[model samples]
Target: MMNEAIARNPQIQSMRYSLSSRFQAVLLGAALGEILGTQCQVMQSQQPQVKQPSQWTSLSRWGFSDSTLANRIAIAPAWGRVAVQLIKGLIRGGGGETSWINEVLDVLEIPFEQSNREPNSERNSSEQDEGSPLPDFPQIDAGLAIAALPIALFFHADPHQLEQELQQADKVWRHRPELSDGVLAISYALSLALREQLDPTQLIAEIVEELELNRDRPTTTDPSAPSNSANFVEQLRFTQSLNQTSLDRATAQIRDQLSKSQTGLDALTIAIAFHCFLNTPEDFCLSVIRAAQLHRNPQTTCLTAALSGAYNGISSIPLSWRSALSRGSSEHSPLNHLWGVATEAELQQLSDQLLAAWSGAYDLVHLLNYPGQTFAIAAPKVIRPH
Candidate 1:
């Protein structure tokens, strides 16, 4: 069964990485990006919605070092939770809508009926106190792009299915069309990475072409806001010109371009993610850290880290951060739990299951667990930590 599944998926066979390495990297990188990026987010807030923890008082001084504060703090972003649920939906539901939707809403503690209802703006403000859970469906931003990771991975070989699944998955947010564009761009980029077809020089161009093509679809086109594609395209084009400059200079250029284009927050965040990734395509740590520091937006940083991970594979992530992710405790720690994945081994298991589903090898877990079983997927190279 394993050999037949592998035989059917020639795309993975030709790749430079093992299926497990890329899958684990994407999940781990996104989680780490959120851990570090949200710290920056919290530090930037002068009057935070939740009380600031004392440990983070010196965040500015730590500078996102590999062995420092980022590994110790586990701040789970909404995107990580959403990505996990999406994985469940794909594997268990067989791409069915209800399974994934319920999985996602269940984690957020929101019922399917309540998903469509707008939050009561006039409700008591005290309900959002420190002890309260993060709100379901927080404002749609570039970070939400990470939630579509499963769709990209599962449907990378099928462009039509990839686009369709991405759109269906995005509808849960009830966000603006522009936000959907950002999600599509990020998802498509991941799909390209998984196929080993991603070219740093041509990534922006390809994404812009995809956005334009999607704009032609009746469901995505906004006749009233026709300039949506044009605006995003302009911002993305500017990123392509960014060379191997310092993170500060690259961030400044991104800010200047956004100011000149007068694009929305989602656009700015997506642009920042692309700029950070393009500037340091080979270094996952540097790319994600630059993203986190870019205007202190967790979503931008998380998405940037995800793209870097997909491109570089899991071996590229720093050892200290990987150790923290695998060993971190979930008790009172939001970062550790991504749909019951509190440790590195659990996340890797989930990734393997996802790969099994994608490859049509439903019994992969059984084969992998039994020492007597000899089934193994061949790879071009063995992945190892740097």
Candidate 2:
């Protein structure tokens, strides 16, 4: 009788899915959140009354922003080394004409000729002058968070190693302590979730403590010094305190404390609050939508969705939403036009390569080796300090 009962359940007979699926979900969720959040902001501006959740259907076009683009770029071969070179160029006073910029543009598949064109003919003479420093990387603010995602996933099981890698990666942020801290907190939280150590209610407090410890330690031995204000930690605590209250009150509080300004700390706080409010993986879509409603900026919503999706495997993401995204027509889907390729199959392939690299079965070099991409080399194991 017990055998017969077990045989009746097909779910029990299915093979277990791989961790790669979760990684893919994380990226997909971030993309979806960005699309939904952007659309919500448009709706809010167009109409005074809030739109019903049901009004948002799969047919709606989802367009990804720079945040998603940066995330995709971060997945390229040897991205850390590329980031290091870019930072070095910045410090050396390299202008917009720096080779690193071209390298980045190449990897992103953006047309190199586009850089030569003036942003706008209306710009002041001084702005367009040859001496004027080319504007720093346009997406540097949220790019920190996006870059940290792959790093966090790579070092998910080792917090100590994760911290070390993050410290080394701080070169990308230069003197922006708050920005660096925001990225650190987000990456650490994602790491914990990946390792299944995340407790939504206690997550904020734990991260605060971790940041405090890192801050208190002297950095003379380190290449980059820590650069954060007390307000970042305090804000995190404030957000955590609201977890005991109703979601409505928590949302209202966060909306009041954080402005529409897309500051690094503000973005991180919003993501943390949404994660806590939802308090469960099953609430991923709703949490991201609420985050979007809280702010029009796509960064906060993208970060929130990525974190939630990391915690909840891809299976938990609503099939309807995925279907809507996959079936979006070119006329209705902004993603295809903006990103060039927006199919589910392409995303899955990227996820597979990333997962392979993370698992030591492949390295960045192997993944980037065109035509001979099938050849994989063992990834070097990350050694944690004793």
Assess every candidate by TM-score: 0.72, 0.64
Residues 1-386 of candidate 1 have per-residue lDDT tens digits of: 65666577666456777667888788878777766666555444633564423343234223333323333444344668788877866766556445344555566565443334446643433543333443335544565577777777777767777887665543343435456677778878888888888898888888888888876776532233333446556666666666656556766876676577554667767877888898779888777766665557777777887889889999998886665544334543435533345666666767777776677765654734642433344333333234
| Regions of model 1 farther than 4 Å from truth | 1-14, 44-77, 97-138, 169-175, 220-229, 244-246, 255-263, 326-328, 337-340, 363-386
- Prediction 2 TM-score vs. true: 0.64
lDDT of 2 by residue, 1-386 (tens): 65565466532333133356567667677666655555555555655484434322321333222223222322323323333333333323322233343554454444433334565665545554644443334444554565456556656667877677666533344445566677778888877676556777677778878988988775522243345667567666665566566656866777776654345444445445345434544577666765664455556766777788877768767776666555535433433432333565555555556566556553344454542344332224422124
Model 1 TM:
0.72
Q: Please list the residue runs of candidate 2 whose C-alpha ends up more than 4 Å from where it truly belongs after superposition.
A: 1-17, 46-139, 218-226, 260-278, 329-332, 337-340, 362-386
Model 2 scores worst on lDDT over the 10 consecutive residues at 58-67
